[model samples]
Target chain A: MAETPVRFGILGCANIARKVSRAILIAPNSTISAIGSRSLEKASKFASDNGFPASAKVYGSYDAVLDDPDVDAAYVPLPTSLHLKWAILAAEKKKHVLLEKPVALNVSELDAILQACESNGVQFMDATMWMHHPRTAKMREFLSDGNRFGKLKSINSSFTYEPGLEFLQNDIRVKPDLDALGALGDTGWYCIRAILWAVDYELPKTVTALREPEFNEAGVILSCGSSLRWEDGKVATFYCSFLTNLSMDITALGTKGNLRLHDFVIPFQENVAPFYVASNSRFVELSIGCEPSPSEHAVTTDLPQEALMVREFAGLVGAIKGRFKA
Target chain B: MAETPVRFGILGCANIARKVSRAILIAPNSTISAIGSRSLEKASKFASDNGFPASAKVYGSYDAVLDDPDVDAAYVPLPTSLHLKWAILAAEKKKHVLLEKPVALNVSELDAILQACESNGVQFMDATMWMHHPRTAKMREFLSDGNRFGKLKSINSSFTYEPGLEFLQNDIRVKPDLDALGALGDTGWYCIRAILWAVDYELPKTVTALREPEFNEAGVILSCGSSLRWEDGKVATFYCSFLTNLSMDITALGTKGNLRLHDFVIPFQENVAPFYVASNSRFVELSIGCEPSPSEHAVTTDLPQEALMVREFAGLVGAIKGRFKA
Candidate 1:
């Protein structure tokens, strides 16, 4: 018998939802079943704008979509302030949840969402889509190789882009009421995640925020950086901003090797991504230069990374449904 | 008449001098006139081992190299402790000095040498050979590009190498009475210079050394890092150590582009050097990836960077001589 794909119901019509909606349509194990907005016409327009199937339902309110029996999972692209209410309610309705990044205002809110999902017996995952990139796993393999990479000595990452003055003054990310953490929660989150990812999720023992983090009038961070140190003498630093040119980078150095990639958050091309690796690197004779140049590794995938993320999440949902039937 | 070449007298038979001696030989307008060590036999062995010309003189004491009238300039490669004495003496003796890096034990010592050189009317330049690489000039051109690489925002550099335990415990760098700054003066100097170079030689307004610098039993730093902040909000960080695998990197981010090179202190190859550049980089639609990949730029030179440094230094000496005769 053919397995039924997990049915997705998007709870908000935010810009990111358009991308995720396309992901759901492309992921083999997922399908867009419904979309809801405060305005019925806008929800219908979003469905067509993002190429949702003609059979997909359009609803005037979020409650109508969650109330339907076919929405096996809810993709919440709502602002941070709305995540706690809608996500917990979606869990109460027994729908699995795929929450957007900066999942909650703080750990406590995230804990609440996690507890609700646990109590309701549903899956919950934040939409950190890059974690599902095939290139990430390849990079990890190099970092984990003791003979090739040795001990992790240091890492530096930065995620920054100029969003212009209008966004700084009006974007939901900069508005404290909507996303209180501001750039730290948005861009800096990726930088911090990259550092943690490079170090195998090892938490640093101390974190000292570098002096001079820029802030708006409402005290929302516009740019910031921090340095972290581990007990084992490992060190890491990260910078993120809304004031610089578009730049995403991660550089990890170990005792025996180094890894660098510029487009960590998003690859330049959907089909192929490249990373540079240098193992056992050293200077040439007389130290006039180096020997054994760094080699570039390119990873290609047929499906875009976002689609892969959706496929992975929906596969977990499908497995859970199969368990219930059995 | 043919332009007279600059005559160089080398003080000490240090390991680095062997490389510089070859540079002097390869450079068009420079020639090694003499080399001196504490033992005449050792100096003679070094001269023969390094393929010095038959006319090159070998002497028993550093004083003899400075006192020789035929020696138009002195290349001082003595340990830091001896720099204040020998560098000043060479300047007072009217030999245009090519001093080794970490020019003196402190700024005051450097000032005294500079004062002597000014009083004696001879040129003075530290032997920072990477500054003369054709690749360095190319990188500077990119960084100075306003339309391609707007205002500089941040920079990070590191220079590290593992010389093994035998050298760490016994090398002159680890001895407090000798090269007391250890890794800071040895490896860190290059990193600091790279940061300053990226910002057009503008000094940072504030600098705070990162905590927990590893030091030897004799109070010499073995590993350390520092963060510098410019008045205009530009920031930079640098790290150096004698405890990790060989790595040299410099990454500078600007408002319009970024520049990165894995081997900034030394090129990976003597004949050709490369650096990666990304201009006007931006994420593709939906931030799935980036657009316009960073391209590798290779610069080729017939003369090694060290030899180019010698040619530049010698050209200055020759220009001074020409002006005096005119």
Candidate 2:
């Protein structure tokens, strides 16, 4: 018997779609069956440029993508402002979703998306790809081990960069309608999400926001902090900024010792990536390398996001198929 | 002409008074002239045991201590719950005042104390002795030096410890009337103060708070993050906690590199005390000796609060005497 692959469609020719659609094509048990954009010309060009399968279809509008019978799941990489509209429509059409990060502009919007997915009995997952990375799984395991980092006393994480106006002009991410979707939302959200995931999804009780508004026209926060608490009374702090050059790191402290991931925001793909663990008055460095699956081709690519997302989506599909129960 | 020393009378036989009174006796131009406590017996015994001048009088009440003509300044080391009342009384008496940390329970109480001091023209300074320590001065210098850490990005700091029940059972710090005075006020204030000082007191625009109430009966925050922004859009974060065993450290990230101070809560003293600074991608161990002018005491003996209070008070006295311009 031949195993059937999950058919996927791209909703909106978002910059993220270029990345996510590539992952979909390479993902095990998955096929990019359709592509969509606001203009038919754009969709057809993207499909042709990316060498989409001859059998794959092209749609002029996002609604047309959802209406396609061959598309079983949809990757919604629409602009932040349009996430809610398309996500609800996708769920209503009985299509499972792998929605891009921020999921929505705020928690309230995320709740609505959750409700729509649940009510329609369609599987849904936030494409916080880092959460599904094997390194994250290892981090969670190490935290649970208790001997390594001890009870987590505090967390500090940051993701920052200074992308020029030219970069912003070409990137939909810098579009103003996204509510100054500057660093805090674009990159800071990842820092917040990583810390939250490490602490088992403990929501921040109070958030003290500080923003360098001059960096962005929309009065968006250039940097911000979320002071969070776990049920065990542990505290976590998250920080993000877009006003400066690129920096991605997370440091966690505990009673017995501390652990620091030097470049945590970007996962280590090669043998040179360094992580530090300190305990009992001694510090040790560990070299971390990504382990590619046997079924996949190992291309000389710096595509941490692409590789991890494809692997994770394939696993999620398998879990839904009961190959493994969550 | 005989240089007349400023006579200092300390109210309350608090542990902090012992350090302040000693500093006063040994200060270049000061004397431990008198002592006072709620109980006359405790006041008299403390005076005799500590070797106050024969002319120094013991007072049964705080008001009596303030009334003494020999008492040029009064050191108020009462409980956290009573800082405001004593500070106000001292300010009203036209006495130079050196009040202990938190200055007051909240900004309102601190404002009242500041107003009283401003109106009376009495020199008032919070006894945050660490600020006077050479290590802090050095940290600030390193942070501001463009050749060193460069533009400040983020700050991560924590001070926590597991104290015995007796340490807090009857302590006013754990009392409900004082309102969240445990970690946030006690150790956490140091973290807040350091961050503010590091960023040159750039006030935060918005504050989000998360607290662990179980750690203190008064709902004192076990940990908190104060996100701040400056006029130029610099961002900073401060974290403090008291639930776990002691771990006091500060990590500051900058454009070129970062600096990490291990055991920041304690002074970097001689052979017995050491601190590590990570800068220029190398860890340097700092061995700091005790202040030479005071005595040949171990650097560890120099509590930040004690050193800072003494130095500031000495400067204030000089300013008031017209020997030094303010």
Candidate 3:
């Protein structure tokens, strides 16, 4: 028998909510049960615009969504500043919380949210959608293959895009109070996560920020980079920016091989992704060129990565509920 | 009506000379005229093994090649420690000099060689083959197009290869008295040169070496990296290694576009090389994916990059000779 599908209530009508809402609809084990916005009309329009089911309720206040008996979980896509107040409140209401990344403004806020979730027995996760992509698993296999990848040495990642003038001037990300971490929290998150992920999540021993970070008029970081060194002598460097053209890359070098991909965050297509691998590559006669072209590995997925993330979150909630019922 | 080919005398039988010798034979405007080694037997063996013309002279001493009237130029592939001595002598003897890179132990030595070439009115060129590749020109076109590439913002380059156990132990690059600059002179040179090429040879305002460079037992760097910053706010980073699998890459990010290629030093195939260009890229619907994939540009050449380098150097020498005779 299939497990019970999790019902999700959205806390706000943020722009990112539209993408998550669609993911909820597409995930087999999830459904959108409620949407709450400070303005009920905005919530209604968002639900309609995103094609929410007629059964889904629209709430004027976030409290109404948490109070709903049918809503078992909440997807909080609120501003970074509101995460501390709202995520913990959702957990206090015994609702599983799927929080947006930069999960909270700082460690204290995240700690409070985690403590509330643990006490209330509610599951909590962040919307780091790229982690759930199938391609990531395939790449991991290559990295872990000793015969192919050998000892890990270095990793470099870049995630940057030109956000244009309007976004630079008016977007909440540029505002000091709204998304204060700016490019670091927004795009650099992926670069750092990718480096950690490539090295099997082992924390770096030392982290030195690169010099000459470019900041906006409000002192929000527009571009920045850092280098991380591991206790085992492995090194990683990453750069993230909002002022350059779109470029997403992850290059992992090993003693015996290397792995590279241009689109690590989002694939060119929703279903398939490609990564290049060069194993035990050697120069041909007289060092004129290398032998054996880099092999291309394409990984396919049944659903978009975001949907996989929702399904993964709901599966956790479903397991928790099953244990509670028992 | 074709200009006479420049007669090249090989200074030593270093392994790289094998490749350059083939290139000299292939380049229509260049030919191998002599080869010098400490032993006449070794010089003769090298000439015969590399398919030198039967008439090409074999000299037991480098001075013999420098003094030979028929030798218009000397291709100095001697160990880095010997560059200052041989390159200056070649220029002093009125032979144009094609010196292998690292050029010297340091800037002061390089200045002496440059001064010798200038005072003697002999042409001087460094044998950085990739600089002459047609694909380099093609990539430059894209970078120069303001409408497509805009101002370059950042550049990241990596050049590394696992030379295996024998080379790590016996290679001149690791020897204290020879190519002691090690991986930096051997591999990092290309990374630095490529960064300079991307930005039109403008020197960076500041260059800081990355921490935690791996050194061999002989106190030679096996792997290292550095970051460069320009006055115009352009930044570049490069990594070079002798302990990693073969990997060469250049990722140049500009305001309006990006240029990336996997094989920047030596094209995977000699005849054709490919680079990916993403111009004016933007995230597509719902920020799920990007619009339009990077376009691939392929450039083909009849002769390999080294041959092109020899041809270019020969043309310059031929032009000088024409002036002298007139």
Best-fitting candidate, scored by TM-score? 3
Sort by DockQ, top down from the best: 3, 1, 2
In candidate 3, which residue ranges exceed 4 Å CA deviation?
none
Q: For residue B213, what is the lDDT in candidate 3?
A: 90
In candidate 3 chain B, what residue range of length 10 has the lowest lDDT sum? B284-293
Q: Is candidate 1 or candidate 3 better by TM-score?
A: 3
Native-to-model Cα distance after best TM-score fit, residue A134 in candidate 2, in Å: 8.1
TM, every model = 0.97, 0.62, 0.98
Two-chain DockQ for each candidate model: 0.65, 0.09, 0.77
lDDT of 2 by residue, B1-326 (tens): 44457678798997657666766765666787778888999998888777787888888999998888777777888876787898888888877888877778778988998898889878887777667656666667768877546688777676655444675665556666753477678778888877778777877665545553445545655555556656555656666655454456676666544555545555433123333333333211110111111011123334333544575685676567554333
Q: Could you give the interface RMSD of candidate 1 in angstroms?
A: 1.4
lDDT of 2 by residue, A1-326 (tens): 44467788888776667656766776666788898888999999988877688888998989988999888788888777888888999999978888887788888988898899889877787777655445556566666766645677777777655455575554555556773565667787888877877677767555544443444454555555556666666666666655443456676766545555544554434212334455433211110111110111122334345546765665666556554333
Candidate 2, position B305, lDDT: 37
* Tens digit of per-residue lDDT, candidate 1, span B132-184: 99999999999999978888988889888778789998999999999988999
Best by lDDT: 3
